[model samples]
Target: MLILLNILSGVALLVWGTHIVRTGILRVFGAELRRVLGRSANSRLRAFGAGLCVTSLVQSSNATAVLASSFAAQGLLLLAPGLAIMLGADVGTALMARVLTFDLSWLSPILLLGGVVLFLTCKQNRAGQIGRAVIGLGLILLALHLIVEAAQPVMQGEGIKVLFGTLTGDSMLDTLVGAAFAMLSYSSLAAILLTATLAASGVISLKVAVCLVVGANLGSGFLAAIGTLGQNAAGRRLALGSLFFKLAGALLVLPFAPYIARGLSFLIANPRESVVTFHLLYNTLRCLASMPLIDAVARLCHRMLPDRADANPELRPLYLDPGALSTPTLALANAAREALRIGDIIRTMLDNVLELMRTNNAEQARATIRLDDDVDQLYTAVKIYLARISREQLDEADSRRWTDIITLTINLEHAGDIVERVVTNIQEKKILHRLQFSPAGLGELEDLHARVVANLQLGLSVFLNSDLKSAERLLAEKERFRDLERSYSYLHLDRLAGQSQRSLETSALHLDIISDLKRLNSLFCSTAYPVLDAAGALRDTRLRRRVLDATYGKDAA
Candidate 1:
């Protein structure tokens, strides 16, 4: 019992180490990896290489899958290239498993010591994240040593020997056991390593080890599929295609497992080395051979899991992927994209407001107002999503970016509410009351409405790119908009003094609409303030210190 417990503990440590390594590497290089995958759409070979390189760094193919699926979900990657990437990811994981099986017991203590010092001293920076990955590497090496030592004693028992004897001739049962271990461990690399260790200890035959390796590869596909259960149709299809490839590879290879093991044993006498080598060679050859079929498999996956249209597409949060939250930079980017959706919804509302004013379409006004609810729902989703990201994991720049995304989303949500109110006011005060503005007043309002819409579009651009020149222009437009509002108010007063009947009847509603438009303009322009302030272009206060000194004293100023 104690031996079994120790073995389980070692396996648990291995899984935890893989998790730490994956998260640490992702946090440090997640955005760069995203760009590499995003740019790999031009060719299958490039995409495959990108996946192989990325998974090698992160120490988990699942991390690479998440990144690829995210790109596919966002329409940045096509299905064929995505499957090619997964194939590369499989080879990468196989290579890493082979590398880990080497005798690195001497380096474990050094890595653990250095990683602990670095992580403790620089807890919130890139160095700290690197330290985290290093620590995980050390833990993985140590766990492998422990698993081998613990399994030796357990396998020597009569009951274990009897259990192992049954798996010797039954290849299918051995394969199922291997697949179960891989899924349970949540890592095919770990499962394969354990199988190799058991074979080395003489508890399992070389043939059984070979069959398990095939099953372990298939289990990784299952792991990827399970990981993508919450993803969009594109993401799920990518996983399905990868799964099909692995399943097909496993079936074709299982029947020949004994012959393959016999061939491997002739070349290498060590059972452990033979198993690991077979794994590496099998994945490399299978992926290379299967590359050409990527397009066909992708089409099949699409047919199996076609994209389903949402009943209310506007209400759905498209880019706030839950899988991205582990990597702060990726999660922030997803949130930013989702926030832009809110900005778009607000723009449509503003357009609808203008149309409502012109046509007195009460039903249209109500329809537009409901969009505000969608904005609210999206705002809540983004806020909660950002909140789930641990602040300690974010570096200084990412922390600032996190705050900026929250600010933009908040401004957009407020803008949506303001537009909804403007539509409501137009409906209740103008349409319901049967009042009409004079030609001059209506024309002035229309012009102001157009400017507001333009400013909103500009604001979204600034939010996305944070260009200094554009931010400056947006701020300048805000001042110009304020001036226009003041001048228009005075013009309405002039018409009132002239006893214009249309102006007199709709005087209050016209001024109210003008005030609302000016407020909307301010909301849209708020996206620029952070950019300007960060660049030191914005002043601390608009009030003049000289005027304060003259009115009171230097102390007051």
Candidate 2:
């Protein structure tokens, strides 16, 4: 029971440890990664390099592979580049395996302590991400220690030797076993480590052990299969493509098992050499088999996972394609599209909300509420798209720009949320009391709305054109909106004292509406910040902070 518990505990730790590392790396450079990958054109060689470099930095090719699957799922990356990246990620894994071979115990504890402190104390930025990266690296080293210790007993036990022998004795059976085994860990790294240990123990022939490793490649695709569940047509196709790649690799290599064996045989005297040879052979074979026919594989994935009966039809920016990181120009384009989409939704919401404020008709408010779904949906799509982007490969300039986008999107979403919330409040107040505002109060609202609408329009232009000049003008005007709201806020309270009870209530309503408008302008200004940052604006911490605080609010959960 204790042994089983230890194994199970080790299993849980592996999952947690893997998550820690993946999330930490994402924190360190997620935005920049997405920018680069989302922007890459059809340059297969660049895609390969991106995959190798990104996974190498990330310290986990499985995470990178999962990222590619997400892009495919979102219709961002096609099969060719995705496959090329997969090949590169495999090569990247070999790099990580080599890193693991080094005894880094001396640094692991120090890294863990430092990472925990940074993660706890710092604000959200690249610095905070670095803390997470350190902690994840430390945890990974620790998890490896536990796993290696647990495997020691098996290495010495005759039962363990026999179990491994049975697995390797038959190529077909062992391949299935290996595939299942690797899939269980959700990591080819863990699978490779196990194989290396088995080899070092001399529990089985090199040929049999290599066969298990081969099987483990396909095993890693198990999660890809599970990912297809509850996803849309495009998402399913991407997931299926991942599975097919692994299975196809398995099928192709199984036939040439002898060739694979021959390659590893040359390294018998050197275990390190054997490990290297096995890694090279497995990835090389997998890549060669998949490369020329990547498009065909993509087409098959499409056919297998057909479109759903009632798919939500919209242009969603699947932003996280790692191939994009290889091309900053293309990433910039994708970001433009996503920003445009957000701007369009907010603009439309504002237009209808204005109608509600003017006419005071329930129908107008109903229409405004109806548009809320579109805003919410687009928000979800953009957030996920950004999350999928690979950040490690970005240059320093791009990294800053990418982080700015994250802030921009959050501001946009908050802007929309404020609009939605105030609109709902207005609708509720109207439905309950049916109070009409005085002409002066309505005029105040119209003036506030006009300024906010103007800011939104200018901010959209600033974002699309990368125009800091327009953005600066908009930022100044955004400050002027504060003056507008202050005038409105004071005027409404004074007038409410003379008005009838319903009129008094309407004045209060006008004050709230003007406040919300002020906030919307604040968000719009921040939204423009990313474009300015991308365009090389002088960084202003106070200006950025004031608006960001208004948008997220100090009390925001």
Candidate 3:
């Protein structure tokens, strides 16, 4: 009974250790990973590297897989990258298990000692990454020890031993039981690790342990599948590949079980190691065999979940999955991507505003309204997501992003308000009153439209390329738009006053659009502000001061 209690306590600690390791690494490198995932489209190799790096840092393959799936589901990551990431993730997790198997209680101290010092001592990104690596490494060892201790006496229980014998006896039966155990266990990684420890202690035969290992792999795939269930075709395909690789790999190994068990036994003892080995070999072999033929899988999944299907890609935004919330850095990184989607939609609405103004095209005007409604829907969706994230405990960087997301949602909604106004107040008024702009008035509006277009592109381009040069250009162009708007406003006013017979409706529309244009310019500026902050320009007192003075000073003036 005393042993049982300690084992339970140790299990608790394993959870805590896993949490500490995953969150710490994400706090350090989530942003960089987001960029990598965001940029790669057709490239599977790059995706695989990202998967390896993320899982290594977080020390949890499931967490990395879920994050990748969520991004792919949302159209941010391509299917190929996701597949590669899943493959690399297998190798990454095995490497971690291998590292933990060695007698490294001594090195845990050294790593953690240096990690603590580096985390506290340095103000650089490299130091942060190093500290994270150390903590992640330390956690793996500590968790391994605790989990092993927890399961040690379990092997001693006669009833449990009998159950294990029955469950792990048949290869297929063992696979099913192992998978079920893994799914219900809360942490498949823990389940496998505990099993590995039993194997190490010689409590369970290698054959039984191998079945559990295969089961754990399949169980973990459920997480990736659930995430992609409501996603786009690419996301569904990525999820399919992750599941197929694990399940197919398990099926392949059942026939050659004896040799595989012997090979793993030579290396280490523990169900966890067995689990990791299966995971590694499964992913590596599957990827090598099928990576060149991935298109077939992609094509299969595509037929299963087609592209033109405008299915509502549901994302929990918050608690979307309890499995994910503990890793705040990655969660926050996901939130930022959602915010960018909101921004991208607003850019389209702005384009519509100009399109209606320029061509008086009825279809374009209707499209603008339709798109505006979509943005509003997306805004509400994202706002709810960010709000949920805000409720979770966050580190400093994640905290800042949460705040930015709140501000961004409100700002975007305000943008919708401006678009609605343009649609209702200026646009509807123009066509209703049948008021035509004088040729001179029309040209000035076109000039303002050009500036708006340039700034919108500048904002998106800067985000995509991470180009610092575009930041300056974006700011300059926004200023140019403001100047152009003011000039147009004055010219319209002068014409109305100078011409004794000027229509009141035309004058009113001109003033309203002028106000709308200025507000758009202000939003353009704020859109770039977040990008600058993300670029670390927000920390440079010199540049920060300049941006503040230039933006606020002009506003104050």
Q: Highest lDDT: which candidate? A: 1
Highest TM-score against the true fold, candidate: 1
- Candidate 1 lDDT trough over 10 residues, lowest sum: 544-553
**Candidate 2 residues 189-302, lDDT tens each?**
666655664565455567766777777777766665564464556655655665677777777777777666766776466543475467666776676666677788878866
TM-score of each: 0.92, 0.64, 0.78
Question: CA lDDT of each candidate?
Answer: 0.87, 0.67, 0.66
- Model 1 lDDT tens row, 431-525: 89777778999899999999999999999999889899999999899999999999999999999999999999888888888998998898788
Model 2, runs deviating above 4 Å? 1-21, 73-75, 98-156, 228-230, 256-259, 308-343, 350-369, 376-451, 458-472, 475-557
Could you give me the TM-score of model 2 versus the true structure? 0.64
Worst 10 residues of 2 by lDDT: 320-329
Give the per-residue lDDT of model 3 (tens digit) for 1-557: 66556766665555555656766666566657656656654577776777777776677777677667766766666676677787777667666655556677677677778878887776344466567667656765666676566666777787767755686558888777667755665455656666666676656778777777777778777766775566555666787887887777788888877787788778765555565666556656766776676667666777787777444432223223333455556565565666677677777777777666655566667766776677677677766665666343564555555666666566667877788778776557776555666677767777776676566566656644556768767777777777777777777878877783433456777677777877876666565665666666666566676664554443322
Q: Give RMSD to native, each candidate.
A: 4.4, 8.8, 5.4
Q: Runs in model 1 with CA error above 4 Å?
A: 151-155, 433-436, 537-557
